[model samples]
Target: MAYPFKEILQRFWGYTSFRDLQEDIIESVYLKKDTLGLMPTGGGKSITFQVPALAMDGICIVVTPLIALMKDQVHNLLKKGIKAAAIYSGMRREEIAITLDNCIYGNYKFLYLSPERLETELFLSKLAHLNVSFITVDEAHCISQWGYDFRPSYLNVGNIRKLKPNCPVLALTATATLLVVDDIQEKLGFSKKNVFRKSFKRENLAYKVEYSENKFNRLVELLVQHSGSGIVYVRNRKMTKELAEFLTRNEIPASFYHAGLDSFVKDKRQKAWTENKSRIMVSTNAFGMGIDKPDVRIVVHFDIPDSPEAYFQEAGRAGRDGEPATALLLYSKTDVSNLKKSFTNAFPEKRFIRTVYHHLMNYLQVAIEDGIGRTFDFELGKFCKAFALNVVQANNALNILERSGLIQNTDTRENNSRLYFLAGKEELFGFQNQRQEYEELIKTILRSYSGLFSSYVYISEQTIAGRTGLSNEQVYQYLVNLDKAGLVKYIPQKKTPTITLLKDRVPENIITISKSIYEEQQERMKRRVDAMLYYISSDIICRSQILLAYFGEKKSKPCKICDICTSNGQQKDLSGSIRKAVLDKLNRTGSTNINELIRDLTYDKEKSMEVIRFMADNGDILLEDKQIKINS
Candidate 1:
């Protein structure tokens, strides 16, 4: 029998009821059915699987592509007193082996892992021993080629399903079109067509578009007017820093975030913002996944997003607590033109793509038919410098190579430093006493960590430094000295992207680009870009309606709080009615003096002149020689 889900939710999460379709999704998964859930951002997606996992008899395996997300979920679960563990890239073999063994014997309820780990021998060997309740795939849209941010690694999810055929599958995503929806179902080996989707209409959030020549000034004005925590999204890393600095100069408590920052710095900045130490986070798209701060009053897009899906997901980050919030997009005509140019740069010419392919092989020192299944620490700037290639075009070519299955690039977070004793306790004691300088550091390491004698352990240099009253650099140097003396073996942390060769290198002439597939993807991208551009350029259409209709909601009502709706509503007030009446009289009489119109219409003379002035400014009428005439 299943556990009481409502009781668990209240006991663990302190919620009285599930939001939207969350209860239904949990029930479907509890009944051992394959399900797909399309919940918008902050739709409580984690609970759909998390609550079910708690009520089940065995563990649930969660597969995702983002290491940060996996770590965050695991951390949150642990804080809730739920037993969870995760295995990701950059972990040692011994550590992974021990983690997998714990799942079998330690009664761990959840095991989070990346899709690449599914193809490993260690994981496959341990797959049959433990019972799995269900399989949850987060960010399921990546399985579809039609979706933005596609990852080929996500395709391995189907293989995991085959290993645990009895277990159900629950797939979740924040944004997906009809095409992507169908593709996810087929790719993930869904048992049947079981899907639960929440409506994408955010009634309480106002979507606003501002056209401005000086965007920085307008941004500052908006921030001052709307007082609350917020996020300002820029396009590149440099912009993240520059904008954050600009906000600070204006007296706003702000900081910048990007993927290139160190892991410790990222954690510190994110914590400060989450706790309200900082009022705003100016960042790239790398920020704001799995963030639980609910009172973000605004989300500003300083740069135009590449697609509507990305825009909707990022904009939906606001108003998670269900209070009133706003999603503001600030852009100019020049920005739109630049976006068009970027689209061309995003997919370079076929010849250029092939050139990048050859150059990458040479850069990595891989000969033809060699370097299969090898991972390299790749630096994009270094590669571009070595070949004299344009950075934008070069990165786009790398993306094309990834889509073509030539290589895979993963942005890995830095792992913590690791070390273990190479000598026995007696030998280490003798050495430490003989050296006299290393005794305190050795004792501190022993107190902070255990079981280091037989296996390598993840250790924090900062923690050790604090305990021993030494600097982190001193601690690191002492560890290196110990390693050189054969008292310990140390592995410093790694903090760079890993590029893996999927297939053996082939000659540039034999490289194949599927014409139909390429053309179809290009066409789909064009439509998405066009839709985003339309959202920015349109002034008369409801912003909410466009977003809703794009996500397959064909009959959504206009959100009356959007910029367009608000403007149109304001134009229909009493003044607007009076203006229409005055226009009618003028059209009939051809022209009229102010005093004559006021006397004939018998309306308020001051209000009448105000309406006339508004009309004249908006090009509805012309006032020449004190006569009001409608403009032709």
Candidate 2:
């Protein structure tokens, strides 16, 4: 009994055919074989697992480290009438439990969770109860130690095989080295070695690196040259706003984006950029994941990225529509040392790490042998000010602890106010009858929102207040009161990062940064920094080749469209060789077809055309009826 996969594609996506290698990967998963798919950044990686999972009988479990991607995909799937849910950092334990239970009983088609969730005791306890079709790992390179963005939490993605032994795994990544490829397959416990690769080449996208002292002018020049939608990636939140303002001052339509912005604002600005209402978006690296804008004509890096993988993925955002575009990097003097300093700041001394951990525990008020499974909102600026610590080093230390799996400090995420009715309708009616004072608010809530009884649903206190003629504070109090009465579980909206204690708090001396998380990881960061430095400084190698080789594409030919090749083009002596050959051919034949002459020339075809254009411009040749003739 097989489902019509092609019909499923048309029914869901309204597509006549699959993109390159999508069908094969889908077919491979349908056969229940573990697979590693290396797709380009904009390649349709989601379709591989989605089509197959929809055809299969049970829910598909998708694991990814990016919360933005989880929310984006879940929202999109829900819009398509596909039952989906997401569990990631910052979600309440109750919400996670409810979502997992729904996945078990509600006939959901997809459940997206972060890799860290896989190792949680709650998730582990519920694993055996799920009727899973398969597990899909996005950004699978994180599981490999050799990968640039390795996370110890990602290791637990492999442990699921023990519970769902027959559920095949599909791992997808935009970029991976040969070593990473093998490591991913082994770590995931693939039954046999199988890899599906889409070429990383972007023929229409040109990669460029520019060196100039006046960076702002260069940026303006680029914007003027390429008249279309673009992205400008900087290094910090401040830079995003400043650059965007500057661009706007220069008469360029621009907006800024970063994680710190309110969720509504972020969505609004992202929408503006996507719809071409804003011609340019100046942002930090947080802006690009899970966005589906295809006509991006250019992506400019105002500052260098940390690793080749990061750079490649960011730059690859352009030319997504298979049209001509440019990925330009502006290199400056200070960037090199700044990147090197970042590596040192990323791995503080072991003693300092322990010190930071102790201070964090004190800040969160977690006593020894306690605090496990509890989450506290962590404000870095406040904590650093309190401890008189360097913000950069303190942040790095927190990351180290997170990688060590002692705690989880995630990025700032926004959660809307949500509530779930714990009691059935009859019980709620009885409770409302008893509590007549809350009757109006309850009725308004029931009229305004749906799905509260079955699961959590977004609720707005202000909107409820407007409708009920009550103050916003009054509405909030009523919701809290209802939660306290055990009739509802209500959580207020928040935009803060939360640090969850993964293990029991211990004395400062007991905190140990393992070698894998510290020393070796430092070496890896150094190598990445060095790779970035080498990429910008070296002028002879094709930029594309350098990036491709870094990803284990050793046999790739030079792109010929990168900065190095074009620079070589400028220095190439086409006048001496191609010039005389064209003259001799024209003199012998008197005149020849311009295409035929360049096609017949043995020299480089592009160089030959350049020489022909030079002759035509300098009055050395005559063009008539698509033929070339020497000036008489």
Top-TM-score structure, candidate number? 2
TM-score of 2: 0.84
Put down candidate 2 lDDT per residue, 361-445, tens digits, no spaces. Answer: 9999999999888888888999999999999999999999988889988765555577899988898899889989888999899
List per-candidate RMSD values in Å. 9.3, 10.0
lDDT of 1: 0.85
Q: What is the C-alpha lDDT of each candidate?
A: 0.85, 0.86
Rate residue 395 of model 1 by lDDT.
93
Candidate 1 residue 465 Cα shift, in angstroms, is: 4.0
Superposition-based RMSD of candidate 1 using all C-alpha atoms, in angstroms: 9.3
* Model 1 segments more than 4 A misplaced: 14-16, 92-94, 414-468, 478-491, 568-632
Worst lDDT 10-window in candidate 2: 568-577
| Local error of candidate 2 at residue 197 (angstroms) | 0.7
The true-versus-predicted C-alpha distance at residue 271 of model 1, in Å, is 1.2
Candidate 1 per-residue lDDT, tens place, 100-140, comes to 88788878789998877787788999999978999999999
